[model samples]
Target: MMTPATIDPLHTPLCDLLGCEVPVLLAGMGGVARWELAAAVAEAGGYATLGMVREDPALIESEVTALRAATDRPFAVNLIPSATDPALLEAQIRCCLDLGIGAFSFFWDVMPEVIARVKQAGCLVLHQVGTRQAAAEAEQAGVDVLIVQGVEAGGHVHGREAGLDLAVGVHAVSRLPVVIAGGISTGDDLAAALRAGLDGVQCGTAFLATGESFAHDYHKTRVTAATGDDTVLTDVFVLNWPKGAAVRVIGNSVTDALDGRLFGHDPATLPRDAIAWDGDAPRLRFSTDSPLRTTTGDMEAMALFAGQGAGRINDIPPAGVRLRDMAEAARRILAQG
Candidate 1:
């Protein structure tokens, strides 16, 4: 275990608030960040979140129960109100509250009513934003932390700015601590964010490549081999998501088929070709669903979400080891300065 003295440089108020020794946060990637990954990260002293977007209450309850069984450390449940149905979202929140989840993470849009509901239940709220305007709105909505994402982020990018630039801008205006997300995969990235006066970082692609991630092995292998250039920010994978929302995914056969026509492709006009399967359910070619561990069929045709930082990741280690190494490396970098 990393002691406070070893990771002192990387520690921030965010750590104390989130009940973690390190300031790094594992991004709650849907289908990828399950109970196993979340538990591994939390046990490693970094705050973790279970990506429970658009999931059933029973599944949420099961994952939360398993997570609590694995670690007593604090963790958060991630949900997106903009993408989920109102009734299902309400049920998800109720289930989480019943499970006594201490924190919640929301993305995409600022839903004050949802935040207020969680806050009313005495849960801490963390919101990820893409723009300064969104950050301001989230702060006003009573979010405890702001995760400023840049266009370089994988799986549904919300901002047009770069990660560091957006974080700097959001940090200037918000009284709450800010974390940068997008192209943050290495220790240097984390150290640089801290040196820039940001609170911490929220990593998705880095953790998604870890052994504990529920992402399909094919997806993990592709991410490890890909460079920043291999990623394309396109709305090509728009099915099941709000229209106009874009995602950054590694180039695959599906992306190749629509090479020049990456953007503005209407979902209604697209063919409902089933290219993969999650158990018995057929996953459409352009659906927003990424290939999970249980998925089969043409996995390459599925959305393989990865940030520009994919090039820097070369191996799939245990989630706990990966996070611990990152914190220690960041500490060394900070100490040297």
Candidate 2:
């Protein structure tokens, strides 16, 4: 039998990054992060991240206000340099400074100037990278933390050549604290990540089933029903946006139709055929849509975003309950070591 280790809340660097009791961060997702969800994670003794690129600066201000009102616990805001408008990013930074936001998560080749600005503003700067070189540069640039995203993640995968091995990234560099993401859906995985020398695990797919998540009922149901084979990565979704970052989404008619068409077609000329429903309906699509829809019960068309670890998730529950269980399980697993 495997031996258990003691729970050491203060031993990990992730706890220092977010000022939380533990290093379990709820990874940010555009259009899926909500104030209630973020606050619930913080309340449950885990860090929460609010996505920055999905909305305007003023909306972010409103979200910050709502989040602040809900909980005084520290939380993070994830920003993508490639996707966010420059002016809007500056404004968001200014607002975060004004509100005293605890931490900032950045990715996609951030400028040195932006890094300096955020540092000067008294916010903890966290960089997301897929390569060992990026992690070294983040350390050189003076970032406070490093989030290493793997191939099995739900959204844009970085390191196609390096693969989604968390051990590679964690052991690749010793200069900074590494936080591993992608396919982290269970306490066993979390324990393994910690043993691999990672500071913590950032999980997006695991939290989708939480009640406070902004995921639609159909989306949540699909995620609940998914297996390891349910997800696929392709550039079919965000072709309209620049770089057209590859995303892993659950298999559906939309992904099925575009199967091999992504290589040849001009993304601009692609026809929009899916009905965009906005009012009162349970299903909805944002501007950054790919026409793929997930089904729930009788519903056939709704978007379901899931990571390759979809097989690990089996049910939906409140955010607090799930997080509590994960932390307890991880603590127990660690104690066995």
Candidate 3:
């Protein structure tokens, strides 16, 4: 068991429940939140989550192994059930359970059976919800925690409400501990969330700009240079995901070209032109694939996911260092009150 250091003014029930010293959580950004970043956040006394959406079982096992090797601290593996095929989701969960992963974080839709299955195997479940209905359902499905994601969140957004309002609404109705997501990039954001009675804050665009993140350097640079106005929530990048799934990304050529026609488009009918590549696999235009460290070819045209918080992040520091700095800053702010 990793003993958490006493972090004054920042520690909350979430810290104790997740076995971390701080209430900050690294958002499980698919492709971005790999083993290295997750391990760094966990080692830095913040809860970490490895994004394993629609991944092969072998890859999941390898990433989990790498994380465990890096630190004994508890972490969760994030999975999106609504996006993943049922069979693949089952395989992913089984692989995680077999690897003895202690916790699981889910997003998009609530799958009661999946939650119950992981709970049966003695793993904690954290579900990110965008609406009060989803939060209530997740609580009823036995999730240990709720992540209320506001529409301001980057990548795939499930709710239309703002982060704080959604979190407060969920907290009022649900018995589960709640963490707020979306547009949370700074220490002030973290402090405000806690002060608003939310348990913690989960950050994506902030952490995506960190050194350990698997996002391409271009993506990190774009995020660091961007302002809140630079991000646009659109359904333009819809391939591989269900129709109507909107994602917030840095505005680029693709978004510019499809400005007037961002929604109600069918992914199946879209041209399969290879705008980028990850190894030998061709990434199609309008696909949900973002620029990862291994991605190449017209990187700017790819989905550059960032939240409004992208404006707040100015540097690409080490993941552990950035997380600690955020926690310390939040502590200082909280102490003033």
Can you tell me which runs of candidate 2 are displaced by over 4 Å?
1-11, 161-167, 261-266, 272-274, 278-303
Per-candidate TM vs. native?
0.97, 0.87, 0.97
Model 1, which residues run further than 4 Å from truth? Answer: 1-7
What would the per-residue lDDT of candidate 1 be over residues 1-337, giving only the tens digit for each residue?
A: 9985655888798888999998889998998999999999999999999999999999999999999999999999999999999999999999999889999999998999999999999999999999999999999999999999999999989988998988998899879999999999989999999999999999999999999999999999999999999999999899888887899999988888875888897888888999889888999989999999999999888999999999999999998888988988898899888
| RMSD (Cα, Å) of model 2 | 4.3
Model 1, residue 155: C-alpha shift (Å): 1.1
For TM-score, candidate 1 versus 2, the one ahead is 1
Q: Compared with the true structure, what per-residue lDDT tens digits does model 2 show for residues 1-337? A: 5333443632486686577877788888766667878998899888889976646778788999999999999888887766777787778788878878867888767567877888887878878777777777777888887888887887666655323375355556556777888888888777778777678888888887778887676777788899868887766655435555667788777667775564343456655544454333333321244222232232343345788888988888888888888877887887766
RMSD of 3: 2.5
In terms of lDDT, the poorest run of 10 residues in model 1 is 3-12
Give the Cα lDDT of each candidate.
Answer: 0.93, 0.72, 0.91
Ranking by lDDT: 1, 3, 2
lDDT, candidate 2, residue 65?
92
TM-score of 3: 0.97
